[model samples]
Target: MDELVVRTEVYADPETVYEFLLDFRGYAHYSEYLREVRTVSGDGGPGTRYALTFAWWKLTYTAHSEVTGVEPPERIDWEITKDIDAGGCWRVTPSEEADGDADDGSRCEVSLEVEFDPGSASPDALDLPRLVSFDWVLKKAIPLIRGEAERVVERAVRDLEESTRDVDLEVYVDSDRI
Candidate 1:
């Protein structure tokens, strides 16, 4: 039930960011933690399911994700179906200054939320030592408690930049999955 929220301003329009968020197939290309991501059903909107396999803390997790909500060029929410109960959303909007020129590439701000406990779903799992808490291992690896989300956001941004670079500019800005 723990939650971490991250917000970042990118050099892209809100629409561009929204469409990019809809492209689930590009996750593995963006974050190394995401070992694989493929559509299981639907497209990128509500009911669209995705099979996601990722590694964290030397363990691999496989989960099914479903898009739960979509508001177009603004917000998209999702829910996890198996493995772990976790989901987050992308909120895209023009920055204050960009309000006057919404299409300017640098005016968009994106907020990402990632909520997860990172522990086994079974209650008995926590009874075993070194089985339920991520605090210890993460602290040893990071100096600050909030650093994990920062790292996630940093890597996500870098991945987005890299993925966009490989695509035609117009595609990222126009095509939903290009």
Candidate 2:
């Protein structure tokens, strides 16, 4: 399994950040490779399913995921239900700077963690050209997938910070293979 941990401090209340993450439909806007996100079932809560379409180079694939857990103003968890074996969680917590004062739109720490195994992912969902082989595409794409999570999180943090407030933000990323 490969894991990615991205942490950032945003100038927004915990609930606001949590609500942003809960809205999965907006996720496609954070990454260029992510073409679209369509709700497949349920509401924007636990048990909600989403189909995320990703396009890169000459390949396009749609992955399905389901919301597994939701804790208001604190956490949201989800798991990939099709194509790939993966799960992730978004955590929002009040920052030390916003402990007691500045209740209205205070600062919060946001973290996203994802664990995925490319070897466990099926290539059947990949839309490939007629002559291309799955093995060749997978060999090339797996390496890119390792770094994709980091890129997405980096963009998410920057965009979230910009959208919420005009503040300079720093994103910390840690990746490991388990």
Candidate 3:
């Protein structure tokens, strides 16, 4: 088993970042490797499950995931249960500026650990000897995953900002009643 960790900081509030990450359906908009995503069971909170289909080596494979932990506007973790070898977490918190202002923006980090089985009875075959010789598979996949995660976060932040730009907050104020 091989493990890799990748982290990135996104410019957004914890709540906005957390909400975007929780919505698996939004992955297709940002994740370069993910071709399609479908929710198989439950909503996006803890215990939610989804089927993620991605292209690997010009072929597509589906994986099942269940949310293991969920703390609103803070952190979320998920476990891969079928057709894949990975678990991941998304963490969000205020920046260290001491202002406690999410509107000023914050940061978020995402990490994943994956293990590939060389002896599994699966369609994809692992070249054990080559892996031992050069460790190419691990080396290649980690960077790819890291890049995809970064792209996803970047697109989500941009989308969030654009969606909120046209809202008018003054409409909520009732001057006559006051």
Top model number, TM-score: 2
Error of 3 at 68 (Å): 1.0
Of 2 and 3, which scores higher on TM-score? Answer: 2
lDDT, candidates in the order shown: 0.64, 0.77, 0.60
Per residue, candidate 3 scores C-alpha lDDT tens digits across 1-178 of 3343434455567678777778888788888788888999888888899888877553455777889889887778887786445576766665655575544565544333333342232334343443243245444454465456556655665686664233221111111211
Question: lDDT of model 3 at residue 79?
Answer: 74
- Per-model TM-score, in order, reads 0.67, 0.81, 0.65
Enumerate residue pairs that collide in model 2: none
State each candidate's clash count. Answer: 0, 0, 0
What TM value does model 1 have?
0.67
Which predicted model would earn the best lDDT?
Answer: 2
Mark the 10 consecutive residues where model 3 has the least summed lDDT. Answer: 169-178
Once model 1 is optimally superposed onto the true structure by TM-score, how far is the C-alpha of residue 152 displaced, in angstroms? 4.9
In model 3, how large is the Cα lDDT of residue 19? 79
